[model samples]
Target: MTAELKLALIHSPTEPAQEAAKVLRDRYEWVPIEQATMAVALGGDGFLLQTLHGMLDRRRILPVFGMNLGTVGFLMNEWSPDLLENRIERAKTFTVTPLRMEIVTVDGESVSYPAINEVSLLRETRQTAKLEVLVNDRVVMPELVCDGVLVSTPAGSTAYNLSAQGPILPLDSALIALTPISPFRPRRWRGAILPERTRIMFRVLDPVKRPVSAVADQREVRDVATVAVAIDRASSLTLLFDPEHALDDRITMEQFAV
Candidate 1:
């Protein structure tokens, strides 16, 4: 990085993050978030995701450098109080495009949202959700009886997707994981990996009896009758990481953990 590199430091509202932000502010002069070339996010993975989504919503292309201060910081780097500029200079860049979720409700309301993790459809009632899975306008599964289902990006494979028995995807893999949460029928059926560009559609079999909700990361729409999900390659978010501990390396390490 050049000496003229101006950084915008933003931290979560958590106490630890606020404290660290004070320390950073005392040592370095920061610029406004909108005017800076890059951003320094101080918090956990959740905050990082929030920052990314906010940027995506505004069509801002600011690259983020995340330093973990929260409990779970899988997407964050180890925090340092000293020589922060040098760390960013040595960091690696990783670009990821988010999924666009087009949701339609039973009332005929339609909305679209962007998700960096996975677009999931979950049952709102105690009743099991019955869904018809379609890919590229073709019926793949006529009916899937389960608690929920999700389409996960490579970067989010290890998150809620993993807990739902979804496959873990490599960072650079040009594929997405389509996994069911808990299947009442088709007990033996495992999820499939589709090409990253594939368009996935899920239709609620009985929206009135079995209410279903579609969620794009944090943005959620209730009583969704149909949802179409696809990767939005036109826009992308870039995150920075230390070369020795890049996102690809972290994802690879997750696969070996017991």
Candidate 2:
């Protein structure tokens, strides 16, 4: 009912996605993002994240149904050209709250960015980054001398976190994964799992020498100082998935993937 009434078709810059968009638009009369009840996105995980961010940028929170057309389709569903509307009508929604990264640069300018995946702190140069970990304003690690670190949501634990040898979390779990990038001094520290609402903070021990940057998904803030990260519980995005291939199911299956 609502899926057929008002829907928008958005795609990435890839040739396949553009071609798919043309075919979808030709078959279905979809409206713009501003006037749509739901949006059907084409492309891979990166484009899907972009689409979600675009919606948040406009302060619109419509449901997004993503079709895979990229290398890694971790956050996308299988592409079906037939009965797109019918599939959307039967789709299940999963609400994902992004991590809010508050970054203050060397100039003391504070800015906030929302990450749908994970917020990673990376070394800018050849020098190893010295980072101090804080949880709820309490010091956890006095100094971590290594590449960098990150805080990942259950929705993102399978992405970069898994690649970094971090634990994979179930989608519905009310927890976050704190994983280290590469540790030299503290080789035994395997990171921690905190509650979803915990305020995890990272302070650069010698920011001037180390020069670590924080990335909130793809949005990057360069240079200096403290980075505070936490889930933005006030805001969330609903992603639509086919019943048989839901996000939670995928997350569970990923743990078993060899």
Candidate 3:
């Protein structure tokens, strides 16, 4: 086994990425983005999310090395030209599973997708949306009048979930955060930390009066009547990081930072 060190480069179509691509092409034996054991991603957190979405599979583990080229490179490496191959060879690994969202429209149309960050349901119209939330087929909150509701993975606990006054969960913890965007009826309903295996269901109170939209990461479906969410532990994804700067440690440190 010749170590199977095939490298792929995925970059945002930016000036910096173009320059970096040229450098990698000139120096290394790189393959197409679709056929590489390790993928070097260029851009910020958004691009990283897109990359994860593009290459999400359980059996095929593609270690990704991201060099920051966009703003807020929380999931990226510091941009540097030196010791590139060395850094990749010595990189660490982090395994993450995305949440699966099954959304049904008012007309009985159904669509399912995976969410690496979070699955959110928001009001599509001007009227505040009313939702009935359930966990594992049990009615937890009968009437959750709010602008929106979200279920976030531990890896995504820091994104939209945190800004909505949700708790920051540790990455290794097998927990999911069920957070409300802006609750009106349940004013004191803070949030819930459910088991990763639990299935969550959200039913729209009135699709005609309060139209709602459900989003599984970047994929959005409007006029949603009901949405179900679950963690896809069977089909998870893996991400590689610097051993010293592991993603879990970074997320843990983000909370205590001044």
lDDT of 2 by residue, 18-95 (tens): 998888877888887888888899999999999988877778888999999998788898886789888988899999
lDDT string, candidate 1, 92-209, tens digits = 9998888899998999999999889999999999999999999999999999999999999999999999889888999889899999989887887779999998999999999999
User: Which pairs clash in the backbone of model 1?
Assistant: none
Judge candidate 3 against the unseen true structure and give its global Cα lDDT, from 0 to 1: 0.86
Candidate 3 per-residue lDDT over residues 39-84, each given as its tens digit = 8888888888888887763345577888889987877778776777
For residue 126, model 3's alpha carbon misses the true position, in angstroms, by: 1.8
Error of 3 at 103 (Å): 0.9
**Weakest 10 consecutive residues, lDDT, candidate 1?**
1-10
- Residue 17 miss distance in model 1 (angstroms): 0.3
Q: Between the candidate structures 2 and 3, which one is better when assessed by lDDT?
A: 2
The best candidate in terms of TM-score: 1
Better of 2 and 3 by TM-score: 2
RMSD of each: 1.1, 1.3, 1.9
TM-score of each: 0.97, 0.97, 0.94
Task: Give the per-residue Cα lDDT of candidate 3 at 195.
Answer: 91
